[model samples]
Structures are given as structure tokens and as C-alpha cells.
Target chain A: MSDSRVSSVIQEWASPFPGQAHTMHPVTSGQAESTGQLAQMEMMPYGQSQLMMREGGEDRVAEQMMGMSYLSYSSSCIGNAPSAASTNHHHQSHGNNEQDFSHFLLPTLRAPLTKRSLSKDSAEYRLRRERNNVAVRKSRDKARRRIQLTQQRAMQLQEENQKLQMRIGQLTQELDTLKHILSQRHMPGSEEGAAGESRI
Target chain B: MSDSRVSSVIQEWASPFPGQAHTMHPVTSGQAESTGQLAQMEMMPYGQSQLMMREGGEDRVAEQMMGMSYLSYSSSCIGNAPSAASTNHHHQSHGNNEQDFSHFLLPTLRAPLTKRSLSKDSAEYRLRRERNNVAVRKSRDKARRRIQLTQQRAMQLQEENQKLQMRIGQLTQELDTLKHILSQRHMPGSEEGAAGESRI
Candidate 1:
């Protein structure tokens, strides 16, 4: 017979494609097409994933990005109502039981989408959308942190203003007291002052 | 004698010069010159009351400024060791008892200096020192307030830095988890994945 070791390699190779195909089964082409938001999501501000240039121009990263995108997409579609209302209406009538299957289908969905890898115009567009979404999320986080910094700085400035105002008050009071004491000496009250100083 | 009212006015006029002389008695030309600082203090930053040009040339402001300055000076000199160390040493040894008389004579000490009222060189000098001291104090307060504002802003920025760092930690954790989930799908053993999704 043929080499046992060689047979093993062939079996390993043969099984992966189906497993991957299984992962992409959830969104079907029809589902992603229905969500109006998915196409618009491609323009996210991270430039493009074409610049990633992985070794061998590998489609592995693209496949991985696709799996993650569809996983997020299905989950989003399940909970999203604003746009998914028309397309998901059929699934809604199937009740909570159908939702459980959709949820379970999540992991298997990844295998199929990733197995196709990043091929075709539509597939390439999906990969870009996923990449842009991630970039947008990171940029939003940076902006949120900047806002927090400005707010905190404002609070600290207010604190310093309060402290300076209080110091001005104390200085004013001190100057006034010093004037009162000097005036007493310069006035007709010098005799009383001299006696007081002697006491000191 | 003339009528009591006329007699009273005559007596009042008669008594004034001696009263004035008595008032001028404490300062003879000698005592002011004795204290070297009175002359030196005049050279202070305000450039003397000669510059006072407020309406009416009314040294009322200068006088008020003079009054305020001397007041602060005496009070500062009282417990202050730096300049007072030499001028006040005699009073210091008086065991706080004679110091009472010296304190009473505080006006006598200044009358010799300010009696000329920005007229004599020494009096002009005293006014300048007082103004300069007030200016210096006000300037110092402004600087102190500015320093406080800067320090507070720095603290606010540091607080923002700390918050950003914490957020970065959370984002990194999220990215790692997302990457790990993606890597798992890319690797082998994907059959269990399809089976799991099917259960849903």
C-alpha cells in the first residue's frame, strides 16, 4: 500500500476545507447583503488592509479578519433592530429556540468564512470593512481619553483658582492689620503705644 | 480781659506754635540721621513720592501709600531680624519693658523720617522704599499664584496620563483576546467547532 505517513498528511489537508466552509455557513451571502450598515462600514478611517503585506501575501490574516467580522456581524445582527428589522423578521417568528441555534452556529460560521480566505471583490470589501471597524474603535478610544484629560485639567485649574483667591484674602487682611498698627503709632496715641511696646 | 469768646481764640492762636514746636520736638535733625536705614530705604524701587502725579498732586494717595508702607514696615521690622537686627538691637536688649517705650516712640522714629512729607530728601526716600516694598509683595503674590496654576495643570495632565494608561491596558487585553480567538480558528481541531455551533 501507499505510505501510511503520506496518507495521514492527505487526510489532514482534506478535512480542513470543509471545517472552514462550515464556519462561514451562518451569514450566507444573503444575510450580509441585507444589512444596510455593513457596506457603509467599509469606509472606516484606518486606511486599508491592503497595506498589511503579510509574508507570502498571505490570505491567512484576511481569512482571520473575515471570521472575526462575520462573527461580530451575526452577533450584531441578532441584537440590532434599527436595520435588521426587515431582514430578520422571519428569524424573529421562530422564537427563542431559533436564537439558540443562531448563537450555536457562531463558531462553525467562522470556519467556513476563513476557509474561503480573502478572495473575490465582495470578500476583499468585507475584509476592509472589518479592518476599518477595528481602526475606528481604537481611534474613538484615543479621543475618549483626550476628553477625559481636558475635563480633569479643568477641575484642577478650578482648585488652584480657589486657593489663589484665598491667599489674596489673607494678604489683604495682613496689609490692613499692618496699616492699623502703623497708624496708631503715627497718631496722637504714641504714648499708649510706647507703653504697650514696653509690655512686649 | 476781652469777652470770653475772643479771649479763647487768642489763647488758642497763642498756644498753637508751642504745640507745633512740641510736636516737632521729637525729631530734631539728629535722630533721623542716626538710623542709617531711613536714608537707605528711600532709595527703594518706587522712585520716591516725587513721581506721585494723581489729581491734586494730592499726596493723599502718596500719604496713604506712605501710611500703608510705614505700617507694613514697622510691623515687618518688629519681629524681623534681617534689617532690624542692627537698628533695633538696642530696643531688643531693653528686656521687653523699655521696648514698650521704644514701641510708643515708633511714631517718633518715623516722624523724623516722614515729617518732611516727601519734601526733604530723606522723606522722599522713605516713601519710595515703602512703595517698592508693596510692589514687590504684590509681584511675589502674582508669581505664587502663577506657580500654583502651573503645578495644578501638571497634576491634571498626570491624572489623565494614568487614566489613559489604564484604558490602554484594557484595550490591549481586548485585542489579545480577539487575536487568540482568531488564532484558534486558524489552527487545527476545528471539527469540535462545527459540532458546537450545530448544538445551538
Candidate 2:
């Protein structure tokens, strides 16, 4: 947008996030219109977590992060049914890394999915299943809120950012006006007027 | 709101934007949690803006930021019938700043609200009014998009903040686990067992 209000938004973002000044190598400025376009492109989400909102917000991010971190862990156990074979294979594949994050992950992942086995339908298993479901829901809700908090956090940062930018703009205008006034005062005719006044 | 998801939304806000790491002068962290809560109160407009959305991603944020900024500026000027008296008062109120950002704002503000006086009913006046109406729509749309961009910028920031926190959480967990493992190994006999073979 060529409008001033729109242009300001574009400019604020085209500049670096606060305190990242050292990282933001300054480039030549564009015409106001193009600058706005530049900011829109740069800030657009390239492929940010497509958290299926229908599913949930933070939970999806957690799921994705968890899935990626433990892909080998989840995938390996997917068919192996948490048997000793899968655990052995998991350790074997990860022989060098001392991480057993998967070791903790495997039992938790396998438990809730509970393998549609006949034994899973038993009252004891159902009760256990209910408890697990409740826990999962609780964790998911926590995750969702966490995600929301982070989002709010993001908002505060931006507000602070906008406020700072506004301050910068105001200062720049003030400086410009002061410079203009000083220049006018020193103009040749103005200098003569001042000298005449002093003589009087 | 106490649902884990909502509480997290609240908590995330309650905490300070990360990297104020100095004042986080760690006074047992609960008070900070409440502080984060106060921030949440400020940032809830931000969260409501979040809309638990999983679809069409970041474009939405750009859309929102553009919307809000324009809303305030636009709503303020709406329907007051930009009269000569109001314009005179506006200038007089602005007294000798040697700046007239409002000079730029005036024509754009008035054209759409063409006064209903018989003088404006002339064909030339009607034609001018039509052109002004189109320009007004264009400017409004641009203003709307600019506001959306600011809001989106806020949203993106929150997302980044969340991601950073998640990484911190993961790293802390890893550190704790390593400490536990190291404690176990140094428990005296565990070292030989670890050294004898890579049996682990």
C-alpha cells in the first residue's frame, strides 16, 4: 500500500527485530511502495508448522517436534509392538549417541495407542485407557495454552517493537524540523535582520 | 481459562518476553508467572487474534496486522463530516509544530465525506466526488492490509518466542538427564560396567 499508515507497517518489519541490529546488514532503501511489498514477502510464513488447527495448536507443534525428534523411535516401534526386538534395534541404531530420550518415549507412545489387542478391551485395560486419555487431554491442553502464551509473548514483542519504531519516527521528525528552523534562521536576509535587531 | 491450554496461554503471557533475562532476577519464578499473567491480560487481544487456526497459515497474520492499524485511524475519521470548523480547530489545536502530517491527511479524509450542500450537487462536483469515493476505497483497503500486517507481525513474534522456549525446555531436560546419568556412573561401581564393553 502506498498509504502512509500501510507504509509504516511495512517499514517497521523491514527493519530488524529489536536488538538484532548487528545482524541486519542495512540495504539501500526502496521507494515507499516497493518497500511495503518487500516486507510482506519477507514476513510471510514460508512453511511454518501447519498445525492442523482443527486438531489443536500447541499439541500439534509438540507432536511435530516430538515426532521429528523421535521419528526413528516412533517409526521403529510402530510395528514392533514395543517388543524387546524394537528396543534392541533402537539402541543398536543409536549406538553412539548417549540419548535415551526414545527409551522414555517408546513406552509412552505405545501405551496409549494400546494396539487394538483383545486384552486392551478388558475393564482393567479400559480403566487404564481412560486414565491415559485424561492425561493425554491434560497434556494437550497444557500444550495448547503454552502455544497461546508463546503467541502472546510474540504479541508483546511486536507491541514493544511498534512503540519503539513510533518513537524513532517521532524523533527523526523532530530532528528534521529543528534542522529546518536552524537553516532558516541562518539564511542571509535573516542574518541581516538579526544584526539590525542587535544594533537597535 | 485454567484449562491447561488456556492457562498456558495465560502463563506464556505472564512470563516476560524472553531475554529480559536480567530482571528475571529469579525470585522463585511464581511472581514472574503472575507478571506473565498481567502481560497476558494486555496481550489477550493478541491471543484472540491467534484464532487456533491451522489452515492457510501466515497470510492470516499479515491480514490481521493490516486490519487493526487501519481500524483505529479509519474509525476515528469516519462520519464526523469533515467540516471547515473541524479542520480549523484541528489546525489551531496543532499550533506551530512546523509539521503538517495532517495537511496530507486532510484531503484524503474529506473527499469521501463530500458535504451535502447544494454547491456539491453540481455535475463537476459530483464527478469529483465519485473519484474521491474510489480513492477512499483504495486507501481504506490499503489501510486495512497494513493493520493486518502489524497483527501478523505480532503473531509471528509470538510463534518465535514459543519455539525458543520449547528448545530451552528440551535442552534443560537433556542437561538434567545427563546429570542423572553422570551421577549414576560415579556412584562407584557403574563405571566398570560401562567401560567393560559397549554392552549398553
Candidate 3:
């Protein structure tokens, strides 16, 4: 149940195959509640052709990420609140030139940046963050489920394969026994002779 | 492959499962050559329990993303160049109050903003973006390969299952035939006589 134990298991389960060098960055922002972020990032590398354990570790990681997101979101909002002058500066700096638009003739319908800062402090930014967070969570859960299903399917198939091999051996042995009996009944110069031969 | 055809296939391959309402946002920034960004974004939704064709379409999409990154890097650099005054403003605006650091006493080592703006125009920003683009590409390709391998494994298992079932049927038939022959030899009043009954 401890974070360290879960984190270590996750690290092993998700280590990249040799030579790939797929470095999964842990969530390193020093927040005590940020245990889940590392797991989320770590899981990204499990898409490699390695067999990862989807047992209890993934469930714990998922919970951790869910808890971490709330804290991270709140902290980010506090740190990134834009001031009035900074918002004004951002608006004045982004200018429009029709000449720059000539190359890509799409409709320029977005209103000027002055009307809304779209800063971390803004309502729009928070809304977008909320939506993105939900999307990311959904995506992660779907991925975990897929991996679990694949593992189950693989195990089922392997069992089936073994059963098939055993059945093939059984059939071969029975066929041999039947052929031997027929041969015994139809011996070249035995007591049952021609009658048994006709039957065979 | 034309962009439209690939896009249609991708859209079908990655449509969210019923009731999930997972709306995947396409790359809407209209630049004519920005074909790959949509595919990249679309692939994220494929982690759901659906069979996606990692055929010609994926290869095209990967190429498109690689191509698009160069253009995006170039365009973003041009648009986000920081001004001298803005750099100064950013430095002055970000204050260092020791009180704010009391809650989380980590080393605050990043220098003043004026030392390096880290804007889209900055070399540091470009380097980071370049690294991120490569990491994303690697991650995407690995995911695609995993999906393909899963599909292949599933098919192989199904085929093996069928073969095993056929073998089981064949063995059952052979066992039945041998039993019938033995029964005929040991009948109550068969012409084979008491000698056959002794052998049985």
C-alpha cells in the first residue's frame, strides 16, 4: 500500500526494452501528494513489447494519478495567476497583419486577445484544464483495460494450445491402436484369415 | 495515400466506444501542410477496445507528423519571439519572497527571466520542443506496434484453437471405431466362438 513499494514495482514493470532508451519522466514537482504523476508517466513506456504486470500495481497508480491531478491543478492556478498589466502586455504584443494571413487563407474569426487573457487564472483556462484532465483520465483508464484484456486473452490462448496438442496426441494413439487390431485380425496365415481380411 | 482517405480511415478506427463520449480534438490550426497533427491526435483514442488498422494509414500519419513538426517549429519560432522590454517586464514581475517558499523549501535555482526568456524564439525552447517531438514520435510508434502485435497474437490463437478442436473430433471417432471392433469380436453368439471371448 505504500507509495515506495508501488513505485518500485511500476518502475520494473515499465522499464523500456534494451537499446530503446525510452525515458519515462516522473512527475518531479516537489508536492507530497504528487505520487500518482510518476506512475502515469511511467505507464507510457509499457507500450513496448514487454510483458507488464497489470495486477494490483496499475490500480494503485491510477488512484494516485487521480489524487495528484487535483492538487497539481490547484497549485498551478495559485502560481500562474496573471496580473492586469501582464494581460494587457500580452494583448498589445500579439498584433494582426493581414499580410501574414495571405499565405494561409483561412477565416480569422478569433477575437483579439484583449477581450480574454486565457491565462492560467482565467475561467476559460480552468475550464479547458478540467476538460483535458478528464480526457487524459479516460484515455489512461482505457489503455489499462486494454492491456489487461490482452494479457487475459494471451493466457487463454496458451491454455487452448496446450489442450489441442494433448488431443492430437490422444487421437494419434487411438488411431494406431485401431490399425493394430485390424492387422491382428487380418494376419497373412492365421485362424481367422480371409473373413477378417474382407472386413478390414 | 491522400490525406482525406487516411483521415476517414483513422476517424473510423479511433471512434470512441458507445457511451464513453470521448471526443478527440483534431489539430484545427489551419495550415495546409498540417495533415499529420490530426492523425497524431486521432491515434490517442485508439486505446479503446476497438480494432484499428495499423496499415498504410499509420505510416502515412507518422511521416506527416515528422514533416509537420519542422514547419510547426519554424512557424512557432517566428510568432513567439520575445521583445527586450517584455523580457525585462517578466523579470521585474516575478518576485522572490522567502515567505512564499516556506511551505515547500526546495532550491530555487532558475535565474531571473531576463537571463533567458525561454520563449518560443529562444534556443532553449526550440531544443526542448525538438526533444519532445522525438519523444512523442517514439511513443506513438511503440503504441502502434503493440496494437499490431496484439492483433497478430489473437489471430494465431484463434487458428490454433480451431486446429485443436478438429483433432479432438478425429480422436473421438478413432476411439469409437476401436470400441466397435472389440464389441463385434466379443458378441454373445458370434461365429468367432469361445476362443475370441477368452482373448477379450
Candidate 4:
């Protein structure tokens, strides 16, 4: 009866504390190869169960020692209550699932919470936000200034082009007047020379 | 008296035809060198003399042949007439100056005349003017199209920026709601667990 109680307590702790119990299980010669394979798996990068080993190593060892005493008490309860092991396993799994769900939700929830927790008056966050705001404002102002300058430059170019076109027109007109005067001078000279020669 | 009248006729022709007046007095080596130098000067690119040479080569040469015969006659008519050699030199220099001025003005006047003579009906001139007009029109159209395309591109980018800003705002709001729900769930669960343990 005592041995059955002890086995029930071990089974209960094993289900919840897989990492510890799995590591502590006695290895017989027949199970040596399977134990080696399990150890290899634990060393892999995907072995998240090993993470618990890194935290509270000494405290967990002490707890495990204390758990032996608790085991005796639980075993007494278990012998008297046969349904206790399965019920505890069911509750433990449910608690673990809830914990996993909470872990998954934490990061999603943390982002906005951290943003909200940003103290309105704190210098660090306020200064950073203000710096970003100032940079944006300065860039907008610079862009506006550039646009105005471009418009001014375009206006200046247009005025210069108009002046050049006017100058070209004036030059063209002057050349035409010069040509007309030259032709008039040539016609009289040629006509008088012809008449004089015909009379001679 | 007949010889004197014949000499008068010959004098008139020779006065205008310098090249043919060698019989009156053979062209001195110095005068010939000067004449050759004048011809070289007349050939210069910017001078009016070059144009007269090009336009009246045959006429001027014929007049020069007549002037030579006239100079011989003039020498016969009045043995006291100015030295044929000196007379020839003076006339050549006078002709050089007149030819130079004409040559200079002709080209200056011709360039604009050519432009003016481009009648709206002349195929070759019209084609050249039309090609220039087409090039200018194409450049203006290209510039206008480029400006329009740039404006359209800027508008598209602005629209995209606005959409991104809206998406960021929606995501931020959703995160805030999720965080509020998670915080509420966590607080009440801890409180209920404490109450249940106390009751137990």
C-alpha cells in the first residue's frame, strides 16, 4: 500500500515537472541507448525544457528535497484517494495551457502598454518624441523653402528669356532697315550710270 | 588732228582699264608687287573687295584691258600728261578702297537678305524653318509632359503616405484595446485565485 502511494506521488510530480523527473529516472542497462538518445535531444537548440534547469538551480534542488517530504504526505492522500493523481494532472495541464496562452498574449499586449506607460512628463521619452517632431517640422519647412526658391528661380528665368527674345527681335529689325537703305543707294547709282552710258 | 581725236578716245578707255595700260608705261616691278599685294588684301575673308572680284571678274578685267590702250593714247595725246606709271598706281589704289567697302557691306547685307528671301513658299527654306519650329515645339511639349508626370507621381506618393499613416493609426488602436483586455484579465484572475484559496 505504501509503495503504491509513493508511485502515485512520483507519477503526479513527473507529469508537471517533466524536465526534472525525466532527468532523474534511473537508467537500467536495457534502457541505456534510449537514455543516451533522450540526453542528445535535450542538448538540442529546440529543447526548451532545459531552460528551467538554468533558473533557480539550487532552489529547485532544495525544493525537490522538500518535495520528498511532501511526497509522503501526498502519497498518504493518494492511497486514501485513488482519483487524486488524474485530477491533479488534469488541473496542472489546464494551468500550463493557460500560462502558455498568457505568454503568447504578453508581447502583443506589452507594445501598447509600454506606449501608454510612457510618462507624459518623463524627459527621455518626451525628448525623443520631441526630437522626432522637430526633425519632421524642420524637413517640412526646408521643403517649403525649396519650393518657394524654385518658383522664384523659374520666374527669373522666364523674365530673362523674355528680355533675350526682345533683344533678338530688335536686332532682326535693325538688320532689315540697313538692307533696305543699301538697296536704295545701289538702285540710283546703277540707273544714273546706265543712262549716262546709253547717251554716250 | 584725227590722231589727237583718236588719242582722246583711247585715253577715255584706258583711264578705266588699269591692267591694259602697260603700253603707256610698262608696269614697274614695284607697282606690280604692290598690285599683287592689293589683290592678296582683297582676297581676305571679311573684306568687300573680295566680293567685287567674285561678282565683276570679267568686267573688271575687260576694263583693265581698255585702260591700258587709253593710257598709251593719252601718252600720245599729251606728252606732258601726268606720268602714266603714277596715274596707274593712283587709280588702282582708289579702286581697291571702293571695292573693299562694297565687299564688306555686301556680305553683311546678304546674310539678312537670304533670311528675308525665305518666302513662305520656297520648299528648301520652308523645310528648314519648319524643322526648327518642330524641334522647338517638341521640346516644349516634352517639358510640359515631364512636369505633368512628376505632379502625378508626387500625388501618388502622397496618397500612399496617407494610407500608411491610417494603417499605423488603426494598428495602434487595436494594440491599445488588446492590452486593456489582457491587463483586466490578469488582475481579476489573481484576485479570484486569492479569494478561492482563502475560502479553501
Candidate 5:
């Protein structure tokens, strides 16, 4: 469990491998593989993902990167806020069909909440707090990574853009030189324009 | 409240102005201004934000885009899991200082939760569910917009790349024609070699 947690932290932070700093870092092989896959998955470039989306004949890569599982609300709740409210009211009246309810429902109902024990001292509150703490961390980490990855991808594209522009400039200069040589040689009255020499 | 909600929804989704779709849309002037600001804020390109980050001597743009407010956990809870656990234990001892506590604590502990109404039928549960529903929508919309923005950036860069490549090709072909003309004209023995017309 501890190794998995460490591995997940590395993946979430996208931190450089700690093994580089500490040569003897004790990581299980499974932990290493999982972390490696997550890093690879996130580090995939935006252009490459678009290509993959086209090649696969679907947007699975884009969907996966968007964290589809976390965002997958029922279609009923997606765009229609009015419908979502009505759905909530529907559940309020027919509470028996609670299994289909979303994150709004408590995950486990081992025991009902009691006002007397609702104080922070109670075990239930502690359990709930612990669970929420984990959730908050997960959500925050996910958002932070998304922002970081977007920035990284943007930087990559910017560098590529610069390189392509430079290439165009170089080609343009070369073409200009070639055209200057041709103009010098093809001057009808200046047949002896220094044979093959052009200032350009 | 409803107008604010709709304006916020527009900002979160970064959807095109609805006024474009409904000519008679009833948007208050203030709502229109707020939505316009948010749209402008989010539509700022990644490169422009990076430049702003540099000029401002801070990463305010990046921080804002990352939704720093939502993710700002106390330092105690951020990275040090063990410290976070201990912090929770400390909170358990000092329940009086609940304000410093994060989302784990109920936002408003009205009369305390009692076991009887802990079921879904309670007004407390309904209120909590509604608040959570709003939060869920806000978080999902923010994430979806982030993904869309990143993809939009990638597409922009890809198109730029293609244009640059095409320019290079044109330059290269032009250069080749120039060189062919120069060679044809500079041929010492071929003085009448189509002086200005080399089939190029």
C-alpha cells in the first residue's frame, strides 16, 4: 500500500524519477511499471494524440486524457440543469431506487447519521472526514496535473513553431541566393557578368 | 442569483455567447459584461498567458487558470500525507477551531446531524445534495473547458506548422528553378540558350 501510494504521488505530480537522486530507491517492479505507464500516458503530446484520435477512428485518447471516468455524469445531468433538478426530485419521492444516484449520495450507509454523534468526536465524522480528505487530494492533484500538462504541451508546440519558422527563413534565403545567381547569368546585355559570380 | 448562475455557466463552459443564437435573449447588461470578461479571460491563448506570466513577474494567469482557489489546501495537507493525518488528529483534539478546517467539515453545521433524519428524506440531506450538485457541475465544466482549450491550441499550432511547411516547399521549388536558369545561361558554349526563357 505504501509503495502504491508513493508511485501514485509520483505519477500525479509528474515529478522526475526519484531513483535519479537516490540510486538505491526501493521501488517494487509493479510500482515502477504503473508509474511509468501513467507518465507515458500523460506526457503524450497534443498533436500525437490528435493523430491517434484520427487513426483510431474515435476520440478515445482525447476522452481518456479528459479523465472521462471522473467526468461521466449521466446524460440526464450533462446539459439539462432543469432535468437534473427534476431527477433529484424524482429520487426524493422514490428513494428506494438509490443505487443509480450519483456522487451526491453518501457512498456507504453503514449506519444512519445521528445528531448526537454528529460532533467531530464521533467515529462516523472522522471516517467521513478521512474519505473527503482523500477525495480532495485526488481532485486537486488531478487539476494541478492537467494544468501542468497543458503548459508543457504548449511549450512543446511553441518550440516546434520556432523551429519551423527558422526553417522557412533558411529556405527563403537559399531561394533568394539562387534567384540572384540566375538573374546575374541571364542578363541579356551583360553576358560577361563575371561568368558565375553574384554579390548575393 | 439566476442571472449570476447563467453567466457563470457560460464562463465555465466557454460556450459561444448565447446571444448569437437567440436574438431576443434576455441578458442583463451586467450579466453580459461578466460573461464577456470571463470569455475573454479564458480565450487568452497559452502563449499569451505565458508571456503575461513573464511580464507580471508572477504566475497569476497560470494560477487563475488552474483554479487555485478551489485547490488551495492548507500547507499541512499538501504533500505530507502523514502530516495531514496528524493534522486531522490535531483537529479532533481541537474541534473548537473549525473555521481553519477545510472541506472535510460541513460548511454550516446548523443544528448538528441526528441519526433520525440522516436518511435522504431530511432537508439537510436535500440541501447538501443540491450544493454538491452545483459544485459537481462547476468542477466538470471547468475541466471540460480546460481540455477544449488545450485541443484548440494544438489545432492552431498544427495549422501553423502546415503553413510553414508549405511555404518552405514553395521556396525550395523557386530556388531550384532559379538554379536551373543560372546553369542554363552560364553555359559558356550556349550563348543563345533561351537568354531569359529557360522552360522554368
Candidate 6:
């Protein structure tokens, strides 16, 4: 599926196709017939792998393609055991190019399922539904934690503000009393002065 | 309080207290009485601003203290408008060290108090509480999203797996048919020419 891998596969297929045609020797009739059947299956348009390459170094592309092809073949062999012989024969007819056959089959194996598979009773349909349920549950939990942290911080700030206000009030009251005394002192001469002079 | 700010404050307080001692000064009788009242208030220790200094920093400390004292006296004057004269006299009597007094008062006045205010007034409190509520809501939303994403991924994987399984089944069926064909071809005398050649 990676661009490099696809390109490498395309290269492998393109390089070997002509060579294989020239090298073909008559095999036993029965083997040849079986091989023909396999070749027919490999040639199936929809199921055949089509490599799409992008510009990249050949070695790197080849390595990627090889890995991808290996995985595809393994999967196909496991998934389509009945077709294993035919698929193998198809590979042989293509002249022992493991990469070519693998490239050919990989795409078919990875293709999205058709409507028939998406219908009820298909395993894929059931799995998709179950996965959706799990994702919903996880998203809900993440949101809850974020909300809790924010609320805690807001409460803390509010508490601090209240304490500062109270201190301000107390300071104001003391200041008022001081002002009252200053006003009384400014008034005309009074007995209070005698006492004040003695204290001084 | 950040650690650095706290340590700096502590250092200032630990240093020698600045300013001359309280000295009795001659005053008019009326002024004297007012001073007595001011003294009484001061003695009660209604949060007198304490002077704190650090070594080798007299000029800076003095400047800062002067500004702070002026601010404090000005604010007190505003609060005690009726007795401004008495407050001014008191400020002068203390070596007119309004600067020192202001310095002591600034920090106390600046302390934060939003939290305390919230508790006293329901309207303000409700506003803050509402903000906290929003945080909780956001948290819940995030959790939901996380759950949804996870579920989606799981569904995709499951769907892929099912497709692979189906492909495997198809391959098995094909292999069975291929085997049947091969078996039939190997039947006795199926190819007369080949059979004769092999027998010879």
C-alpha cells in the first residue's frame, strides 16, 4: 500500500513478464493444464494486484515491495487455501518470480469488501459495529477528566479573592476612627489640650 | 506565593527596622488630645506597617519606603477625610515618615481577595460556580470523543479481519475444485498417448 512498495512491485512485474514468455518450456500436459488454470485466476482483472509506483530509489522501492508482497501472499495463502494450488501454478507460469505473483495477489487481498461482504452475516460488518461502540466509550471518559481539572482551579481562585476583600474592610474601619480623632483636635481650644500637652 | 517572592520578603523583615524612635513633641492642646487618641489606636496594634530593610541598600529601600508611605497616607486621608488634620499631624509626629508607613501597608492592601468575596455575595459566587460547571461539561465532551474515536478504529480493524477471513474461505473453495480437476485428469487412460509413452 505504500507508494515505494507498489512501485517496486510494478518494476518486478514489468521486468519479468517478457522474460517469462521467452523461457516457457512445455510442462507435462496435466501440470500444464493446472498451471493454465492458475494463470487464469491470477489474470482475473478485479482480483489482480496493480502496483502504482512513485519516483524513488529502486533499491528502497524493491525492499518495500518485497515485504508487502510476502505479507500479501502469506495472507492470501492462509485466507484462500482452496486456491493455493492454482495460485502457486500461476506463480510458476509467471517464471518463478515470487515478487510478481505476490504483487499481483496483494492488492486483491487488501481491497475493500464488496456490498455482499458488508451485508448481514458477514464477519467484517459485525466487527465494525463493535469497534464503533468502543470508540464512543473512550471519548466520553477523556472529556470528563478535562472538565474536572478546570472546575477545581476556578474554585481555588474564587476563595483567594474573598480573603483579600475582608482585609481591606478592616483597614478601612481603622482609618475612619483615625480621621474622627483628627477632626476633634482641629476644633477650638478645649480641655483635651491640657491633657494632651502633659502627655507630650 | 512563589518561593522567590516569599524568600525575599522574609529577608527584608529579618533585617534591621528603619526610622527614628517615637519622640514626644510639643503641640497645641487640641492637637495633643488628638495625638493621644492616635497613640491609643496605634498601641492597639491595628496592623501597623512594619519596616523591613536589607543591608547596604539604604537609598533604594528609602526611596521605595517613601513612595509606599505616601500612598498609604494619601489613601488613609481619603478614607478619613473628616480628620485629615489629625492624621497629617500624626504622620508628621512619626518623623513624617509617611514613606515608611506606606511601604508597610502596600503589601497588605495588595493581597488578593476574590475568593472571599465570592462566598459573601451569591451573585458573584454563582458566576464563578457556573464557570466551573462549564469545565465539567467540557471534560465530559472530551471523554465522549475519545470513546467514539476508539470505537471507530476497533470497528475498522474488525471489518478488515472479517474480509481477510472471507477471502480465506474463497481460496479454500477454489483449492478444493482444483484438486478435483487434478484428480480427474490423473484417472487411468485419460490421455491415451501420454499413458502409452509412460508405459513404454
Identify the candidate with maximal DockQ: 3
**Least lDDT summed over 10 consecutive residues: which range in candidate 4 chain A?**
A57-66
Off by over 4 Å in 1: A1-200, B1-121, B191-200
Interface RMSD of each: 46.0, 27.7, 17.9, 58.7, 19.0, 46.8
Winner by DockQ between candidate 5 and candidate 3: 3
List RMSD in Å for every model shown. 47.4, 31.9, 19.8, 57.9, 22.3, 49.1
Candidate 1 per-residue lDDT over residues A13-39, each given as its tens digit? 235443322111111111111111112
DockQ of each: 0.00, 0.02, 0.08, 0.00, 0.06, 0.00
The digit string of per-residue lDDT tens for model 2 on A1-200 reads 11111111222222223232221111111111111232333233333343332221222111000001111112222222111112111112332333223445666453334332213224433455445644564554454444454455556796765665565555444434433443444465644221121110
- Tell how far residue B71 is off in model 1, in angstroms: 22
Q: Order of candidates by TM-score, top first?
A: 3, 5, 2, 1, 4, 6
For candidate 4, write residues A157-182 as lDDT tens digits: 54555565565455444434433433
Mind giving the per-residue lDDT tens digits that candidate 3 earns over B36-85? 11112222234553333322211110001001100111111112212111
Task: Tell me what TM-score chain A of model 6 achieves.
Answer: 0.28
lDDT of 3 by residue, A120-189 (tens): 3334444554566546544555565555556567668978788788878866765666656666765656
Off by over 4 Å in 6: A1-200, B1-116, B120-123, B152-160, B175-200
Clashing pairs in 3: none
Give the Å error, residue B89, model 3. Answer: 9.3
Please report the TM-score between candidate 3 and the true structure: 0.40
Query: Best by lDDT, which number?
Result: 3
Predictions ranked by lDDT, top down? 3, 5, 2, 4, 1, 6
Model 6 lDDT tens row, A15-127: 32333222222211111111111111111122122222211111100000001111112112212111111121111122322232233445556322222222222344345
For TM-score, the strongest prediction is: 3
- Model 5 Cα lDDT, one tens digit per residue, B1-200: 11111111122212334233222212211122111111122333433222111111111111000001111122221111111111211111232332422335574542222221322323443455445644653454454545556756766887888888887777776666666666666576664543332333
Question: Which scores greater on TM-score, model 1 or model 5?
Answer: 5
Per-residue lDDT value at B180 in model 4: 46
Chain B only, TM-score of each candidate: 0.36, 0.32, 0.40, 0.31, 0.32, 0.29
lDDT of each: 0.29, 0.31, 0.36, 0.29, 0.35, 0.27
